[model samples]
Target: MYEFVTGPLAWIAFGIFIIGMTVKVISVIRLASKKDKVVFNHWSWGWSFRSVYRWLIPFGSRSMREKPVLTIVFFVFHVCLLAVPIFLLGHNILWDERWGITWWSFSETSADYLTLLLMAAAIVLILRRIVLPEVRIVTTAYDYLLLAIAVAPFVTGYFAYHQWFDYKTVLIIHILCGEIMLIAIPFTKLSHMILFFFTRAHIGSEMGERRGAKTW
Candidate 1:
């Protein structure tokens, strides 16, 4: 079971993630080209890049500044979300062993703190969805499920690292949850992970080039 999860199952998860995201990106671009050809008419790379950059930075946009707390938490959660997993010592070691690939890694202590921070942020996001009337109106069970999917790996990983339960079982659950997240990203609203750039670029170009207005 351990061997299969780490070997073939890992490959399958990565394969689906890559292929699914590629397909989605290509399809969206092609669809846009056909349906919204006007978008490209006045597309400005400058505005697009500026928009993406501004949105990437915390409190860079007016809307973000308006909600300072959420902006900080959102940025911290996402930064740690991407950072902790890829730079985790254990994950890097696994990649080194499996594919002869490795990168700079965080100390175990640093990873622990980042993981805890991520979990806390996830909780805050979940609560925000429930507590904020406007946000709650748009929230759905699927949204909560997606949040759970995003955070489950970290939760299980923390337990696995601490060996708080049966180490092997916790480790297995962690790997599985991580893989599930990878597989889900390109298919779900989590796709905002990739699509945010493209959509932001379109909006930025339209608003900036076409209307002489700032998007951010």
Candidate 2:
């Protein structure tokens, strides 16, 4: 039964996932590569690098350092959420068997705990947005909806593993939610993941041009 569910569904999910991602990436790359009136130099790339560096090393910027609590929470939530799924024993085993790739698993306890933490953090973030009117005003409907959609798979998967409901039903819900998010990524604000670098580069070049700083 498990094999049956995984076999055809996995292939369908994977096909949609790959084709959607490819289309989105190609579209963003083409858009970003279009010629701009402003000329860009190496300094524009340098500024984009600097922006990434600042994100990594928050200590370097007062704005970042001042938001230590939010920064720590966000990073912890994002890192664990990303790492656990890819490195969990069940996920790795399934990936290896289905996709012919092998990976080492993180400890089971660690994976489970991190999944819970990520879900908790996601809930907290949603609540914060609601309770904080400033954030609520700035957040679009897509932002809130995407946040819920992104978190649903983790929550549902955790419950499914624990048999909180029927195994097949819960698992199907989790997988379906994940597939939806994957399909939506290209068409939504989530597209920022692919476009942010080019956007930054464009901004950097425009800034340099406006300042008459050597055409970058």
Candidate 3:
């Protein structure tokens, strides 16, 4: 009976995930095709690529003078948060056992540390948005809600890992939060994720045009 329940639910979740991702990707591609071509200046493209490279390296220099502490905290949080689940041994074990995919894992200690860092980052980001006038003025209610939605799964999963509450309940909450975020991804400002590159290129192109440069 338990197997029957979990089996069908798993299939349903898998179907939703696959279909939703396909739709979102197709929409983004269509939108991009319809939009004006965005050109980038040599320096702007160089900086964008450099930022990605810096993110991969342990500590590459990048200026964050405008919001130094907040920028550092945000980057640290994203790095640790992303690294944890993808590299964790327990997650790999589940994948291998359930789906026959084998992958490497990081240490449990590292996962725990990353989880703590991610939670701290979420809190700090929320506080920064509230306390800083510039951040607050620009933030919509949806922005705050989206942040909460994005962070809830990680936070719940951390507690679930520690068995801080009933294991089943916490696990269910974690999964539900993840599913909610998945559903919300293509509909909200979270969609900026799909549009970010184009938006950056468009801005860069406009700036170059203003400066009377042939390149964006």
TM-score of each: 0.98, 0.82, 0.74
Q: Clash number for model 1? A: 0
* Predicted candidate 1 versus true structure: per-residue lDDT over 72-181, tens digit per residue: 89998999999999999999999999999998999999999999999999999998998999999999999999999999999999999999989999999999999999
lDDT of 2: 0.70
The backbone clash count of each candidate, in order, is 0, 0, 2
Model 2, runs deviating above 4 Å: 1-5, 35-43, 57-61, 201-216
Candidate 2 clashes between residue pairs 3 or more apart in a chain or in different chains: none
lDDT of 1: 0.94
At residue 196, what lDDT does model 2 achieve?
Answer: 64
lDDT minimum window of 10 residues, candidate 2: 207-216
Report the lDDT tens digits of candidate 2 across residue range 1-216: 467556777677667767776887787656645853334443366666655555555354455578776777777677775687678787778878988887888888888889988987887788878888988898878788888867887888898878897888888787777667666666777666556666655555565434534212
Q: Report the C-alpha displacement of residue 170, candidate 2, in angstroms.
A: 1.1
- Quote the positional error of residue 74 for candidate 3 in Å: 1.4
Top of the candidates by TM-score: 1
For residue 154, give model 3's deviation from the true position in Å: 1.4
Better of 2 and 3 by lDDT: 2
